[model samples]
Target: MKVLVTGAAGFIGSHVSLYLLERGDEVVGLDNLNDYYDVNLKLDRLKRVEQHKNSYNFSFVKVSVEDKEAMENLFEEHKFDKVVHLAAQAGVRYSLENPHAYIDANIVGFMNILEGCRHNQVKHLVYASSSSVYGANESMPFSVHDNVDHPVSLYAASKKANELMAHTYSHLFNLPTTGLRFFTVYGPWGRPDMALFLFTKAILEDKPIKVFNYGNHKRDFTYIDDIVEGIIRTLDHTAEANPEWSGKDPDPGTSKAPWRVYNIGNQSPVQLMEYIETLEDSLGKKAEKELLPLQMGDVPDTYADVEALVKDVDYRPQTTIQTGIGNFVDWYKDYFKVK
Candidate 1:
């Protein structure tokens, strides 16, 4: 299958692209190479993709999803069998500062992708949603079937909007769309803005790391490989209309059309302090600690109910936080040359 993976230079996107290429799929990776974090990291990820000399199934284009015209052109050019839409302006705290970026990238950009998929005869459109959508809900294990009307941050709101937009497209055009609500995805080549990266960096630098919510927060930190695996499984399993779905008691997770949502998480929520301790152990350095109140648009905890995902894909994320953080620390030390 030929796949078009947006945000291919990004942390998850880069990993997904390589996974697809490894599985003998021709992948066209697209990214604007935004400097939201560091363009150098994005370039380095792209370089890693280019380093695969055997399959040569990967190609990248410099483009942003917000540019509707360019996005349409790319879609028109490639008859993508599957689309993994992973690109977005992704930071809860940052969203509070810059809401328009979320609107443009997460909202407008997603609109363009839905349009493209609707018109281009794409088979399956698997997009990234977030655990942040479970904002303000103190549910022990967050499920896709739960109502997500309340979003704490603009980033979460945009993700919820993407799910709605995809549902609309699926209902209107019969597009097979699946939204994966990822929970705290982390691993090698991870985003610098994410908690794992920040904790690793601070520990290596011997700087104090801010433990949010007084270190009472818990997160279902998922590994990148697990996410990529789930994505690949979902991409192959096209969405189908739930025949039993009724408007009288509609399920939020499934639509009458070919649309579905699943939580791609490990189903294991670890304490923030435990995560810090794991990093400290991995790096052989104790991090200076500063307990801080939870910031705006931030949730105290995130625990994903991945039963549906497992039932659908016959797979569950197996990487523990310790292993995941250890891999990340090793990668960080090797990548940054932290002696």
Candidate 2:
């Protein structure tokens, strides 16, 4: 299998590329190497992929998904058998600050990916969505079958739009598409903007970590390996039109076309304070507490009901915060040589 994995230099993308390459697949990894976070960290992640097992099978390209001409050319040149679209302008609160960035990278960039997949004879397209789409629903254990019409943040709105756009392509062009709504993914080599990374960094530096929602928020914090597993599983199981789907009672998760959406998350939701405590335990340090109100454009809780994913993929995310955060702390200390 020859796979094109966009955002290959990113945390999840790097891990996914390495996984595919290890399984004897030829992988073409693509990323713009933007400075949204640390470009050095992104470069280091790419190096890890290049040095890992079956590294020869991996080839990386410098490109952004929003660049239509470059994306089209790459698709035509590679003739990719499948695509894993992971590149996006992430960060819920960041979306509030810079809405235009979200529009460019999440919306326009996704459009370019869809066009590339459609024009090429790609077999299946698996892209990342977000748990934030369950915005304003106040529903416990967010389910894909439920309605997601309300999005509090522009980032969430972009994700919902991606689903609608994918459904259209699946229906009109017969393109098999699957969207995975990932929960709070965290692990070693995680993004700097994410909570795990920030908290760890602040704690090591003996700084006060801002506890949002007064440490009342709960999240289905899925591990990075679990997310890669879900991606591979869904990629192998090509999307197919649900025969029993009815227009009278439309299921938002499935369609008459070859389009489906699933939630990829740990079913176990952990409170923010518990998560912080786990991190403190892992790092052997305590964080100065600064309890803050729930930041705007953020959900109070996120719990993924991955029933559809389990039914289809026969897999579930099972990493506990203790092990996950411990692994991250070890990596952080080793990566930075922090005593």
Report, for every candidate in turn, its global Cα lDDT versus the true structure: 0.91, 0.94
**Residue 165 lDDT (model 2):** 96
Model 2 clash count equals 0
Output the worst ten-in-a-row residue range by lDDT, candidate 2: 52-61
Candidate 1, residues 1-339, lDDT tens digits: the string is 999999999999999888887778999999999889999999999998888753478888999999999999999999898899999998999998899999999999999999999889999999999999999888779999999999999999999999999999999999999999999999999989888888888877778888889999988989999999999999999999999999999899987899999999999899988888888888888899999998988888899999988888898998998888888888888999987
Return the lDDT, model 1, position 54. Answer: 37
Give the TM-score (vs. native) of candidate 1. Answer: 0.98
Candidate 1 residue-pair clash tally: 0
| Per-prediction TM-score to the true structure, in the order listed | 0.98, 0.99
Kindly report which residue pairs in candidate 1 clash with one another.
Answer: none
Evaluate residue 163 in candidate 2 and report its C-alpha lDDT on the 0 to 100 scale: 97
